[model samples]
Target: MNAVNWGILATGRIAGTFAAALRELPDARLLAVGSRTAESAEAFAGENGAIRAYGGYADLMSDEDVDVIYIATPHPMHHANTIACLEHGKPVLCEKPMAINQREVREMVEVARQRDLFLMEAMWTRCLPVIRRVGEWIEEGKIGEVRMLSAAFGYRTGWDPAGRLLNPGLGGGALLDVGVYPVALAHMVFGGEPTGVDAAAHIGATGVDEQTAMTLTFAGGGLAQLACAVRTNLNQDARIDGTNGHIDIPIFWRASTATLHVEGEAATVINEPSGYHFEAAEVMDCLRAGRRQSSLMPLDETAAIAHTMDRVRSAIGLRYPMDA
Candidate 1:
């Protein structure tokens, strides 16, 4: 109930964004930061107002003062990092694509349950108020029986074979990076795993997907068209088309506004904040109530999404080292 003491496990760009958001919450305190090196940890702590810095991740995890940890390490390290935190008796909020594949994700989930520790994949978009409103609209039948959807998230980045976005060794690709956003959105709207996954990708010189397009079929005849790319720009919008009406979300992943269009009625527009703080708030609320997993972003669903991604990768012949 007291101010939640937080520790961040990495000093990457995403970690910095999350750290800034935590600073805005009066009930949350940035207590410590851990990185591979002392200098980087100290630098992040100084910039982010953290009270302590640990040169090694193990040192931070062992700190009894920290209540929970936010794992912002690269995609390949999520499984190990999350398990370490749980083993240290700390809850975790791991960055999404929870792990490189389903097996790793399942392992992480199992460990959390075994340890009786709170663990959540940091799919921050799902915690946005606007997204919650969208869910309400669907449940209220404002969109009728949802039948089809389309979503795309993409941006062009200059080629750098060794950069995180292009390096296969780093578990880099459009699907894992930007594509997961659209995939997760579809899963939320459809309410379960897709029955079918068909996909195509342009494997770049670095042996990772630079662009990917997928068509997923859900039970009850629902369909979703999704795409992600790191070598091209996309509209970054989404549409959920139901039998009677549809909803349009612009920049849907970090969506702040959406419009509802019924077959024969005026359109309704809604807006809300879309910050990293919402997910952090969810973690704290769960910790306070003694819940081990987020109802909104359940561990089972997180693993299901990873399964779907595995299928997508198999379809496009994309493979990461962890997949083997």
Candidate 2:
């Protein structure tokens, strides 16, 4: 089979990370790059070894050689970008926080469904080996009846209103950027949408959430405590506690190791290299199998996570320009 050709729709940090990951995959090819400016597109294409560089997204979307497109634009652009890709007959892997709001995610999902094209949220944590192991442990009853989950992903960065992290216009905030990691993980473990979302946030001077705390209640009485921040430092660890014991995952969002702590047994550690490659591999595998959406990161779950995010944002009174 011919290698899968990828077109990246941005020149951002995450796009670069994905490009690097694709370089490690023998079946993945970086075929093209698109950016707002020709210079940016050319530079990214050159650095990432993409064969084509387009000054605008339309050009990339028209590339018949590209098998798929990765929407790595800012949070707000995901909806339009993914739709454009799907309309042009290209499958899409959109960045996390799929869109600024749930409504937008639903629309994107609808377009993909209507067109019978592949669409997936780039929730890379779901593809991590350590995270998969955590899932296995829960299924194996290593941690008896998961009752609670807690996760935090935060970092302190210099204040810059125009920067993506703090810019409301860019859909910047801790909740959309880092909070979604924990939120997605909670959905993965609980195997469904949250029954209730209670949240609070610190809205900074830039009018975006600087820090946010969330409590998600699942139908089966499972609960998740999630926190994220841009102006503060957090432990960046996660714990899944059950009736028997708990599973501890450090840097859970990009976890490379996890410890299974049972009540009477010795702690068992699961380890693997962390990279964006695993998610890329999954996308390629699904494509080869003629699947439209990933079973591991289903569109329904992505939409549910988006709905949960909307609830969290509403609870915090956080509104972006993209929110309608």
Candidate 3:
């Protein structure tokens, strides 16, 4: 298998992780890393063996040697960065929460569809093998008719009002950061958008949400109860209950293990690999198959989740600095 020439579009922590892990894949390679500053891009790309360091993102996007561009920029910048990549006719795997708003997501989808380019919101969790196995078990009736889900993700963020967790300008708050994991998890297990949504939040001094709790009622007679907090760390366990049994993912947000407990049977531990490799593998798989979008991370599902999140943001009265 020939390696895909990957490009890292930002010098952030995720960019480094993806670059480092892609090297382990053997069939994937990092060709370039781009940053606003040449020094940072050069340093990052050099550290990861990328042949090119682009001082500007446009240089990376226009580089014919690159196969896919990873958009690791902030949520607020995702709109502009992804559009720039798509406009230049580059395949993109924009980071989680897809974009700062539903409108931004719609535009990204439209451009990609119009250009017939590959694009997906890199919600890496969907690619986890363990998550796939969990889905399999649910489909096989390990848990019949999932009726309820309880999940929470939180962290003691040290309360920096100007930091990404609290800055409205950065599209901060628990909902988009840690909260997205739980919400996405609910969607993954349930396999559809929430028909009803209710949410509440406590806004920080910077006007970003410090903590948020949401209840999403799915059409299939199940409810997902989720909570996220930047003010404190949650135990981060998730549970899915059904008529006859339940599965518990103790480390819900970034799970390494889950146990299924049948009504009259012993709990079974399902261990899984721990890393960002799965998401990269998905990218590799899609590129090799000449896919424009991931069926697992389909655009419609991404849009529905964004729509649900928009409602949650609206109900919490959360407004980012660039919301207009």
Among all candidates shown, the one with the greatest TM-score: 1
| Ten-residue region with minimum lDDT total, candidate 1 | 163-172
Kindly provide the TM-score of model 2 when superposed on the true structure, using C-alpha atoms.
0.98
Q: lDDT of candidate 2 vs native?
A: 0.93
Candidate 3: C-alpha lDDT: 0.87
lDDT of each: 0.95, 0.93, 0.87
Per-residue accuracy of model 1 over 8-120 as CA lDDT, tens digit each: 99999999999999977999999999999999999999999999999999999999999999999989999899998999999999998799999999999999999999999
RMSD for each model, in Å, please? 0.7, 1.0, 1.3
Off by over 4 Å in 3: none
User: Which is the better candidate, 1 or 2, if ranked by TM-score?
Assistant: 1
Better of 1 and 2 by lDDT: 1
**How do the predictions measure up, each by TM-score?**
0.99, 0.98, 0.97
Collision pairs in model 2: none
Residue 261 Cα positional deviation in candidate 1, in Å, after optimal superposition: 1.0
Shift of residue 139 alpha carbon in model 3, Å: 1.7
What CA RMSD would candidate 2 show?
A: 1.0
User: How many residue pairs clash in each candidate at the backbone level?
Assistant: 0, 0, 0
Off by over 4 Å in 2: none
Superposition error at 126 for model 1 (Å): 0.3
